[model samples]
Target chain A: MSRADTAGSGERMKVVVTRNLGPDVMPLLQERKELDLVVWPEDRPCEREWFLQNVPGATGVIVMLSDKVNQELYEAAGPTLKIVSTMSVGYEHIDLQGAAQRNIRVGYTPDVLTDAVADISIMLALMAGRNVRETTELVARGDWPNTAWAPYGFVGPQLSANWVHPTRTAGFLGFGRISKATLARLVPFGFTDCVYTSNPSSTPNPAADAETARTYGLRSVRRVGLPELAAQSDVVFVLAPGGAATHHVVDAAFLRGMKSTAVLVNTARGTLVDSDALATALRERWIWGAGVDVVEGEPHVGREHPLVREPRCVVLPHIASATIETRLGMATTAAKNLLGALFGEAMPAEVQM
Target chain B: MSRADTAGSGERMKVVVTRNLGPDVMPLLQERKELDLVVWPEDRPCEREWFLQNVPGATGVIVMLSDKVNQELYEAAGPTLKIVSTMSVGYEHIDLQGAAQRNIRVGYTPDVLTDAVADISIMLALMAGRNVRETTELVARGDWPNTAWAPYGFVGPQLSANWVHPTRTAGFLGFGRISKATLARLVPFGFTDCVYTSNPSSTPNPAADAETARTYGLRSVRRVGLPELAAQSDVVFVLAPGGAATHHVVDAAFLRGMKSTAVLVNTARGTLVDSDALATALRERWIWGAGVDVVEGEPHVGREHPLVREPRCVVLPHIASATIETRLGMATTAAKNLLGALFGEAMPAEVQM
Candidate 1:
């Protein structure tokens, strides 16, 4: 009944798009004559009820990270849904087990955003390391007229290696695609050593690490424990996944172990780091500074948030992959995945379950 | 008489230091029995009257950029000033022509702070291109609570080359040591092409450009005219030397030639870019955005400044070389240069007249 109300023709397959994919990508869906598209006209998140009501009788659904694919939604769709394409690299919102049992293909954008995440990770590192938060605020406060340049004024640790620092090390909490891309970025900044802590359950391969070292032309690329990662790194990048197992991995003890001159950058999940511990560390000068793109309870992170109140802490609203090119690539990929699954073709970047 | 009043001994040479060289370097001047050092006690700039009164019988003086070396100062030094060691790379404050005419050896810190400048240059580029000013303030203003994620919310241009964009080009107004260091930093970002504009009076060495490309692993590094540079580059870095010859090199016409997606970064000097023109360009979207560490009539740039008021412009307080390591290196260089000049060894980084 909902499908009949939304779709122009009952003969054509129904495809529900949660948001406009923009002119560059919407054309891909609009050009198709064999399908009827039911796109959400609003810019904000499609209301849950609206999404559920519209998803019914849809053969394919294009969703965002906010959209969750569950058994209830599947049941509501009445076995017509062949695919659930999400325009994000993350798939935590989608229930893979339920989708697999229901014989549905799950499509997600992955490699297209690797560069964006890596670029912003390095950006946060540089911003935090160089005191961008305090310095920029000073400019905004009209303090330039009174703040004369001093020898050591607003000084922070240099991110690049010079003659004095012939070798620099970069640490990663997770050495996956995003982390490796970040490592690639550090090489040009003259990073000599690369240490990372990966999934504890995964098998360690020194040979793979050696090959990585060879590829990046680094002195060594090895998998180290979390403590070693905190202690040895000049700049630590938190790029691990979000979950119970990785919750508060960067806690008080870990923060205490970091070098006073070192900078901490997190473009990963905020659950991987404890905000209170980080605030205390910054207040005590345990670490030089921190730049984080995500928080434990983000979207609710306010001016009164502990990390936001810290002068040395730079907080961003979870926008690690917020670049036009990356978003377009994701939208295009999502559209293609939707079209592919609707016509029974292999979907690009489909989650294997 | 002023020197005798300040110094304890008549036999020793008086060395006037305008500011504390910090703990690591002050001992270098303090330990020497042959010199009588009159160091300023305050953290702020040394009063001009105090400097003039103290330099009367001094053999050497270590000055900052705020202290100018001129004819009147030379006349007041009573012909005993052997060297003017400045703890900065730029010698614009020093009257080089006057120093050369008087045969006073000028020592400056050079070949250091290159990495600092380059590091901050990239940092500014990333910050400006990525809507940092708008987004960071949004978080700081407690706006994150209501700003839910949208399909293309807060999207910006991608700095690094992605799968779709296989090549990226970087432009420079001046291609010198600092510019080269900045170029080295961009390689990891997947910049394949490099274009630059040098002194028009200088010879165009295609061979040297090719060698530079080879060294950086870039596809092509060539010298182009100003208009071509603005048109072709994805990012333009203003790193040329400051003075009349290069004043306001990035004016309205040059900015108009640039791509709408381009980002302009100026780490060299305030005079190299026109603040009003840049503000207008940003306001009209002539170019994506701009990041400048220096502004014209600096130490005076307030909230009402045109560039400061623009949301797209990211302004810094000329802290491009504001890193502890770089500052220490500069102080040490200045101290060593002073010691080297006083002892009559080859003064490190001396200005050749």
Candidate 2:
């Protein structure tokens, strides 16, 4: 069927947006009169039924990580769908094989989120090490006036390397773009040494590690096994991908191995850490503290959640890439990806299938 | 009185300690058999009466910022007191002139706290810019699941510069050690320009500013007036000294002049910012948000305090130096200074009047 059969002239095409893209980014799609647009009314994730019904005749669609783009959704869109654009770097929710079978291009927002996530990672490290949550809560609860100033009161391990620990070491579970960005930020904090573990399938590159160390002016940067990463690091960052293969990577055993003064930061994915085990670790002082932006089954994490209830854990709802600059960039990239794929122009960032 | 009169047959010198230094630093003072140490029993600031009563015939006193070292105390201690060592960088609470007149060497912990304060300053900047306090509070309150994930949902101005805004600017109220260290951290976040205001007594150093700009790969680092700093800065850091000269420096006019998207961080002194004006500014959206580690009349900031009640402000209980490593260094330095002054080995960090 032609565009005329749907609602307008043959030049007009239907494009469905999974959620509101806000005033800054909506105009990019709305300005194109040739495209008929449908935005889900809710500020929250769109209903699956509404998406399925609306996407049936759509030539393109924009989605978020919360929205799964799988075989059923592809079948619902039929032959009209040419592209699926997601406003996130991670495409785990999308079925790449299914999309490839349908010859549909997948566009995702990346590179733009690096700074925001990196900022959050460093913030977590500081918050965890400084005990920002507990200490701030005390002040908010009207306890500041009564609390006496003591020499060692409210003290926690410092994030920066100092003369006391002249050779402070940093560890990363996955030394990807965000982790590298975090390392760059920490260099000014007086961190001198570094260790990381990448994907098990990938080979270690000593040359690249050495170059990274020299570039950052660090004492050393080397790949390490999980135990060494846990035992030696002053601060450990979990920045690896989330999937079954990496589930519970930072479990009881891993937490047990961490130094009592070390801090753990997870700005990547929740599934990589075991929430219950981490809570226990914090309770037992197996590790000093944790700062996590994501938790297992997030958006459903209540006050009763293990990590949420952990006094030493700084749990934030998933907002690692929640900066105005980043979200706008993601939305614009998503819109541009859809517009480009629809018009036969090359996508600015297409995910390889 | 001679050493024999002060203690047991010249075997020990009388020393008054205002509070118990923790395990990591206690040994530095305790290991000296030549010192007869009298530690204030409570884990709080030693009362003035108790301190006065115990300081008599003491050769040295180790104190915190909360302790007042006035002329009366100096006279009360008589000619025996040789040193007043404070475990803080700030010495406003101490009577420096009185100490000098009494021939009492003043030692303070500086340099050691620079990294900790600088770390907190950046943490506040990021927290304010990203709305971490409000967003995380929502999550902690179990309201996150209901909150929508709109593209602009928890979005705030990014701390880093990007293609859209290639020149991000950072402003400092004081260009001191902490401010420079904070600037170092911001450079990695993509801040390209900096403006700061130093003490009026300080001579303008164009060469140093130029060198700093080049070292950080920044576009410029010029000393600017309050109005220009307020208007041009994307993030204004109130890091000036806390006294009459700098009190209420970030007042209503300054807040009003700031960009609505800008963030204000105060990790130095709370008096530098007008709490009521800042609260009103945040309430009225005159500015984006603020993160304050220090508040005016602190240790007394209750829930009813305007800054504490402001939703956009993230308040901490004056914990910029609340890091284990920094605090330990401070305690050790204070102890060493006392030991040095008492033994006539030249105080390592003597505060010259």
Candidate 3:
């Protein structure tokens, strides 16, 4: 399609926001005089049929991580769709190839949430390592009436001291922007070595990895296989992108390879870890503990989730980027990206072809 | 009492533990067979009469910060007390001069809690800065149904970004072990300058302060007055000791001097801050927010506390040294101190007379 045809065919650019982004982001579109906005009123997921019907006339759509922007949606939306901006740092929900074929300019809020997510990752690690939830629950439930001092009654590893241990090692699965930031935060806690396995790019560079490690004051950063990462690490952080290519990467073999004193932290995606395997690992004490920000089929997660029921597992409701400051900054950044793209200006974080 | 008289006068070496300690600590005395240990059964404050009664026979007493080991208690003990081992790092509760005159050896647990307290200090700071309490409450109460998207809703400051503005600075009320550790953690988050005030010690030297700052990779660390610390700091952290010398140091004047965008974090002692003044500061928005682990008269703290009701103030139960691993290590260390002092062995951490 030519530029003139695409511009003339537009029947008011319709944008659908799958879930309520609150006023912090909504006003950015409402204030725009040129665009027409349609919002999902309910907090629940938008129906597939409703989304498909709504997308036919839309030139751009602002979606959440929960919304799946796939080939069918791209075909249904047809040639009118020019951009798909997700209000998240990760863009795994959108099919990259489909978007590429359709020439859809993808914009995601990255780096804006690096600090917030990194902070939460550390919080979860501490909470899990310290048994904050269990202890707090004990105090809140008034169970202290029968409590007495006992050896090893309630104890979790202290990350700082543990990091300094001679045997301690850290592992990152698919180390990228956020993992690097997380490593930076964990460095002072005495993490001496790091090994990561990410999806191989066309060309591998040793200098890039070395520079990244130096930036975080890491002693060493080496690329390794999954088995080595699991076997050697005291704390193995699952930070890989979520998709079919990396789904359920942390299986029984991987968990079994981890030391009995090891901890696992997953801030990347729920699908990256096999829920059943992780639950078993925690229940059976294959690893000391696990801190999970995302669980398989989240938002539907409730009391019955294996992680939720396990005392050793600290489960958070996908709050890695839920900080108010980060969320607002992200919303504004996404808005700027959308507005910039629409006006033929440079997008702050545009998906490269 | 001379050494000969003291050695022969003991019926049984009576030891009073002012609060509950680990079971392992009690067993050390039980195993000796020559010691009579009087343990506090409840978490409540030990009555003055009860403490006095126990002190009369106490050759050694294990006390917490809540107990005041003053001259009166010493006089009541009648020269029987030979040692005072405090479970905490601070010694403000003990009357140093009174103990010194009687040649009482004082032992305290320090350096052991540096990592634990530092971890909690960062936790509280992040929790307060990110509105963790409110957000968690929102999820717990199932308030997502009524929530709306706002351009800037529920946003807190990110520590990773440039937090220092011309009008914003980071201040420390006491530049000690925990504060130094906290400073090291904040270095990755872009804190360039730090100002602190410390009580004058016998040997006045700024060398320790300079060395600490340099070790943490901070650009500058300088001693300033209380008013200057309050006026210049964007985030004022209270790690100062609590006593008449530094009681309610962060009063109305200090809060008033703080920038509107500033935050206050108190993990040291509740008495260092004026509760009423802090409530007013938060209610009136004198500063952005506050994260308080210690409140005035804790354990007695309920939902009715002024800071608890305030949205901006994040009130946590005193869990600064509450990490599972740290607490366990502390329990074991405290036990070692008791056993070591009794058997005349070298204690891993001992307070000098």
The Cα local distance difference test for each model comes to 0.90, 0.89, 0.74
Task: Give one digit per residue, the lDDT tens place, for model 2 in A52-114.
Answer: 989997889999988989989999999988899999998999999999988999999989899
lDDT of 3 by residue, B38-90 (tens): 88776665677889887885778877766899999999887778788877777
Name the regions of candidate 1 deviating beyond 4 angstroms.
Answer: A1-10, B1-10
Which prediction has more favorable lDDT, 1 or 3? 1
Name the 10 consecutive residues with the lowest summed lDDT in model 2 chain A: A1-10
Better of 1 and 2 by lDDT: 1
Higher-ranked by TM-score: 1 or 2:
1
Residue B4 lDDT, candidate 2, scale 0-100 = 40
| Per-residue lDDT value at A313 in model 3 | 79
Say which prediction, candidate 2 or candidate 3, comes out ahead on DockQ: 2
Output per-candidate TM-scores for chain A, rounded to 2 decimals.
0.95, 0.96, 0.88
TM-score of each: 0.97, 0.96, 0.81
**Model 1: CAPRI class:** medium
What's candidate 3's i-RMS value? 4.9
In candidate 1, the residue pairs with backbone N, CA or C atoms under 3 Å apart (3 or more residues apart, or in different chains) clash, namely: none
Query: On residues A1-353, what C-alpha lDDT tens digit does candidate 1 reach at each position?
Result: 34333434447888999999898999998887777899999989888889889988888899998887787889888778888999988788898898898889999998898999999999899888888899999999999999978899999998999666788999999998999999998998889999999898999999999999999999999899989998999999998889899999999999999989899999988888999999999999999999999999888999999999998998889888889999999999999998777765568889878
